[model samples]
Target: MRPNIVLFGDSITEQSFRYGGWGASLADAYSRKADVLVRGYGGYNTRWALFLLHHLFPLDSKKPPVATTIFFGANDAALLGRTSERQHVPIEEYKENLGKIVNHLKECSPTMLIVLITPPPIDEEGRMEYARATYGEKAMTSPERTNEVAGVYARGCVELARELDLRSINLWSKMQETDGWQKKYLSDGLHLTPEGNAVVFREVARVFCEAWLSAAEMPYDFPHHSEIDGKNPEKAFQQKCL
Candidate 1:
């Protein structure tokens, strides 16, 4: 049976299969060996995610995900009292929500591996421009999110990983350490550019490889009917897997 790899999160994840995004990269890397499922909801946060988590991710799927990555917090870190309160989740609750999700997944699938991703940094200036253009200058003062504000959530994610003894990738910190990170990685201070996506794909691939070395190198199931002897296609396919 084919293993499943799940990408779960908000808009960033929703766009993960975009041109050079991580989903596509992972799909290409794990072709045939596993099914890469992307279930990203745009503009979602931890609260909304928890409310709908069970509905979105059924525990009883016959082919449960072998690996799952939870990449949220970008929206959860939205300014608390601003108009963006809809997406805002307190840091403590965010931690609780993440732990609950992890526990739920473990309960459902003991063998499933979990990886948590800290939200990437946001460039306030770029976000300000985006807000002005999108919401009009008079409607908004500052963009609802900032790198400093989001860092709290990122820290919570990192801490949870340690507490749970799970691998947590610090995308937030990693992006900022690079030169010109704001321009190179984020398109409008919030979302990932092609370069940012590549980084995510690489890091995720690295984690997956370390966790499941054999699975990472599984051979592609190939040599279809045209290549196989018409009378011996079944045997040929079996040999390929072996």
Candidate 2:
């Protein structure tokens, strides 16, 4: 029987399918190996996902899934106008929301492996422009905060993954290594375009395949380890592990 895998996340996750996003690519890549399901929802935060899990994905013995991947922390950083009742949630609260998701999912399947991906960074130039255009006065007042808000939430996600002992895909660092990723991969500073989704989809596939192969005591293909070299336990272990 094919294993069931669920791709769960926020806008980036949502975009994966809409504009030829990674989720669609992943479902294609894993079609022969597993049953992949893309459950992407735009404009959601970690807290929102937790709520959705209870409402949309409650424990159902009749439809058990083998794996789930969570990619949140984008909108969790959204700011309210100074006059609004709810300001951007603090980073600590973001962490708490992540913990709650992890804890509840664990109750459903204690041994189910969960993968958490860190949100990619936004282009500073794009962000500054957004602030200037949307909140002209407020942007001038808190330009620094406006620029650094996403980083705060992204780091919070990284720390949360560490605390939970979950595997994390560091898209934030990976995106930095590429040139013009904002223009190339994303439709906007926040939402990924089709090409951008392809990059992320391949990455998640690599991690998922690695994790699955590791669990099954199977060797990873290609550069992850030498194909023709003698068995090297240390190198194999390192290659398979994050």
Candidate 3:
């Protein structure tokens, strides 16, 4: 069976199959090598996501993914008393919840590679503009998230990954290294633009390659068409174990 690479997280992950999304890019990158599965929940925080582990990564499953990316924290970092406070999760709890998730995944398969991805920085102005455009007079005056708070969560995610000895992508820091990232990376101050998705794709691909899942190195599922003799196609088909 082909190996599976699961992408687990929030809206960013849910929308990853969209045009030019990071998840879609991964699917293309790992084509014929591994199955890139999406297990994303939009607007979900770690607190809520924790409950889904048993169902999503069941211990009894005959096939477990070779790798999984845990990409959350954006919604959890939502500031208290803001319009999105309903989704807010305290930083401490967020870290603990992530720990539980990682632990569960580890229990599912000790060898499964786990990658923690820090949330992206927020663009407050962009968020406000989005809120105004989407909600009009009903929109809240203040932004629901801030870059500073997102940084705190990102730091926590990185630290947790370090403590657990897993690979992590510090998206919060990486994006800001480029000037004008607010407009270039973020589409609605929270969601990612195609460029932002490219950044994610590049980082994830690098990690996957490092983990020995390089697309160029992995074998395809079936025999190549070129290997089949048109006059005697059954010969090639019978040679493959599948």
Which candidate leads in lDDT? 3
CA-lDDT, candidates in order:
0.87, 0.68, 0.94
**Model 2, range 7-34, lDDT digits (tens) per residue?**
7887676666675867777776665556
Model 3 agreement with the true structure over 106-222: per-residue lDDT tens digits = 988999999999999999999999999999999989999999999999999999999999999999999999999999999999899999999999999999889877887987777
Which pairs clash inside model 3? Answer: none
lDDT, candidate 1, residue 98? Answer: 92
Those runs of model 2 whose alpha carbons end farther than 4 Å from true positions after fitting are: 80-87, 127-147, 213-242
Better of 1 and 2 by TM-score: 1
Candidate 1 local lDDT, 43-71, one digit each (tens): 99988889877776678867678899999
Candidate 3 least-lDDT 10 residues: 233-242
TM-score of each: 0.92, 0.74, 0.97
Query: In candidate 1, residue 125 scores what lDDT?
Result: 91
Model 3 has an lDDT value of 0.94
In angstroms, how far off is 115's CA in candidate 1?
A: 0.3
* Error of model 2, residue 111, in angstroms: 2.4
Winning candidate number (TM-score): 3
Least lDDT summed over 10 consecutive residues: which range in candidate 1?
A: 213-222
For model 3, the stretches where C-alpha displacement exceeds 4 angstroms are none
